[model samples]
Target: MNFEHSDKVKELIAKLEAFMDAHIYPVERDYYDFVHDHSNLWKEWPKMEALKDKAKAEGLWNLFLPHEYGEFSPGLTNLEYAPLAEIMGRVPWSSQVFNCSAPDTGNMEVLARYGTPEQQKRWLRPLLNGEIRSAYVMTEPQVASSDATNLELTILPDGDDYVLNGRKWWISNARHPRCDLFLVMGKTLPNNPRHSQHSTIIVPRDTPGVKIVRSQTIFGSLNSPGGESELRFENVRVPKANMILGEGRGFEIAQGRLGPGRIHHCMRSIGQAQRALEVMSRRADNRVAFGKKLSDQSSIRQDVARSFCEIEMARLLTLKAADQMDRYGNKVAKDLIAAIKVVAPQMAQTVADRGIQIHGGMGVSDDTPIAYFLTLNRYLRLADGPDEVHMSQLGKQKIREYNAMKARPAESRP
Candidate 1:
């Protein structure tokens, strides 16, 4: 199979890499400093705003949306977008500068695919323009959310409006000052079949009874501009027009939304792992331990070598999933997506762990980004679907294949 990226994609990659070096990488410290110095920690960083404006002006905005958006689209196939995603991912916060951050990207896809015309005019337009941010409220504290159908949130019809009552955690981007919307998933018909009972609705953040209970920290550090949040919806109300693609379609929308979202995470994790490897290699070559540089030691060399191999494998698998999504559609690529979701985070964690080990004590410190990278990658292992969940799904698919083959005619099977 042809694996080479198109010329257009290559050109964009060069531009994006240069943008990261010239703008993002240089301001990483300033961005953090701005956040730390500001009292409104949940507010957007001014430096980030400047950088985003510059990136948008340079035509680097919204690179994640596929061709379906028409004039504003990235026009790149999933394979073509892989390298660009990797570049954007090298720095954890850099994705938002180009308006390609998650939760928002996934939410935008839902709006583009399922939102009514009125819904698009109000939410999708601003989202595409990056005028405001949004959040996906799906996971609940009381449920094993990996099985999404187990969600217990309720959206009951109240005359011409729907009243929402639920508690959701890990609601990313909801804490941002500019976050004006929420795509909430809950059950509208609890007694119906598990999957068919749920629906996703658009709930404006300012709606009465919608409260941001608290911001959740990741390993004690609060991610700025938006971190995970705990939210409470006590009779939160929205108009009937707010339901996306009608009632009982939450699972369908979620499947479509997560297909691209999960793969994007995998693509970005490769970049994170690659960056970690780069740092590890540099540290190993320069740092002396027991009378020799770490690079000269057998253990360090083996780790670097194995990390390189693993990162490459994960990248290839991620690209394959993306390509499959592009060619065969997201549903058809489910197995590949599940495989990469399981593989990429573990690959990233291994690379990050090696980097930490190579850096000795400094790896665990904020003195280097390795610690943050490690934490971020670790969260990914559980974020989309835990490794165990994906593994089980993959195993089930394999068993189904084997059973189908066994039932086939003898000649055909042979």
Candidate 2:
């Protein structure tokens, strides 16, 4: 019931907010300019490197990891990390500056929790140090990737190594110049139990036959420099020791990796929504339409009000999920996580839509970040689990709980 952030978190939040305002937003223009000026889609942005180094030197680094990870993380719990993530979310690319971006964050967590000692020494340490980036290759274009058990990638054992053959798409950050690893999920033993047949293995990006087919664009925007990647692994060979946790543990590792990732995504969406609302309000109050400010119009006022309510509701639900994850574990908090996962993205989209409407033509163009924010929010609904999937799962779980309660003796119910 206590929703207040701890003092430590509050202090850090202030620092983060100040950093974003003074350091991040000021140069966002230059950053995008740099992105546009680069003809090579995957080339590293030197300006981003400077900002990252500044953030690191200021000790604002790796705040997403739940605990001290090697020598890089700051040991912030899920609850403590949620608001900070929201701050980073305001600027989509800001998280990476602090070494707190996705895929890498999830990949690092997997290494910290389940990787063998040598695995941690080799991959996790450099990842923690921000020396390299990684991609999570789980979803496939050929299958209903929503059903992760349907992962069609093949990982066949061969004496001392495993040969991988599959196509993975929508992999974020795979095109980064520093992307040195891929956490690939595939079927190692198809005859095992549905959930147990899949395994996650570490495949070096440079491994032979690991091909970068293309970088998929969202809404005609190339979103280059490691936005969305499609890669093919044709007989890519990796050592037997590369399997994480063990064979048939993809589901288990995914369970651990995704909870944090979901919360992080939700928190960022909340931040994105907040930014949209801020921009929308400013635009409405300042702009005159039909001889009156947009703020004076009844419809704009109502939409703004609704956006605020939805943003607050989504944020509270996200915090509830984070709190539950901290108190119990991912398994126990899964219901809440699913609920937030379903709510946060839609909330962001709604708010962003209103912002776009408020901004008129400029919103749809690259003149403002609203267009990009809306795209990200829309993608999120389908990213982790589509709206339909989360709704179905949440609905089924609710029905099961209701059925269990109905079967219980009336007096036994709380």
Candidate 3:
């Protein structure tokens, strides 16, 4: 229960914050200007590689990978990585600068955990080096993707290759200029048990029959560079070696991957909310309304207090989830993972909304990150799984858990 960070984690946090203040915070607006320009669609910011090189040289690279990968990982646990993630989360695009962005982080974990040595040599090496990016193609336009068993994409065996055919949407990183591959999930064994029917296979983005239909927008912005996209796989094929953990193992890899990823997202959401709260407080203190500062108003004071309390609550919950995952395992910590997944995003969204109100007109504009924070947190509710889905599963688990306790002798329960 002790959430005190180890000496190593504290040192890393100090270094990370110093890096962000010196580099990321200074250029935040310039980075946004480059990405938001219509002419810069799908183009990397000119300075991204240099920033990444600096981060790597400073030993800040691959901070998201918790498991030991020899020299690839810094040998930190999930609990240790939480504060670092919160630091990166303050800037949405800054994670990639340190090779800690999502889709890639989750993909790297899969390769490290499940990919063959050859697969690791080809894909994982480049990803860890930050030479390329990747996409996790799972959701679909035709089915309710939240229920992954309802996935309609097909991956059928054909001699030495697996042929894939279907449509996928809301895929992050598909439009990245350096995106090299996709870890696609689809039905590979239809007649198997419900949970065992799906398989994950690596598909090179340049593979034949792979087509990007169009980039999807978040609130009218392209979310440029790493655009969410809809992709079509018409007889796309890859070698059998690309199959990860063999048939009927997609769900297994997914379960393992998502536990850490969910906590990471929550950690980042806390950062975003924290930033919003600070921005709101500053605006309230400085802005005058009706001949008085907004900070002097009782309503504004209440909002500031509530946001501060909620951010702390979410941050602690995320740390507890990270601690549970590190000490126990993803399965043992599933309930807490689900709880934080539902709570953190909603908390961030609420805090951001309040910040937006406090900022008045400036909040809705790109002048600050508050608007994007609201959007990101809102979509996160549907990303890993919907709020209702987690609540339902958690409810069932709690009911079963309490019922088992009830069936035990009263003395034994105590």
Clashes of each: 0, 0, 0
**lDDT string, candidate 1, 1-414, tens digits:** 877777788889889999998998888887777766648588788777778889989989888998766764868777888898898888888899999999899999999988888999999999998899999999999999999999988999999999999899999988888899999999999888999999999999999999889989888877877889999999998999999998999999999999999999988889999998998899889988789998999999999999999999999999999888889999999999999999998889888988998898898987777777889989998997789998998999999898786464665645
lDDT of each: 0.89, 0.89, 0.92
**By lDDT, is 2 or 3 better?**
3
Per-residue lDDT tens digits of candidate 2, residues 74-182? 8787889999999999999899999999889999999998999999999998998888999999989999999998899999999999999999999988888899999
In model 3, which runs have C-alpha deviations exceeding 4 angstroms?
A: 68-71, 407-414
Against the hidden reference, what TM-scores do the models get?
Answer: 0.96, 0.96, 0.97
Candidate 1 residue spans exceeding 4 A from truth = 37-40, 406-414
Model 1's C-alpha root-mean-square deviation from the true structure amounts to: 2.3
The alpha-carbon deviation from the true structure for residue 106 of candidate 1, after best TM-score superposition, in angstroms, is: 0.1
Where is model 3 poorest over a 10-residue stretch in terms of lDDT?
405-414
Ranking by lDDT: 3, 1, 2
Give candidates' CA RMSD values in order. Answer: 2.3, 2.6, 2.4
Best candidate according to lDDT: 3
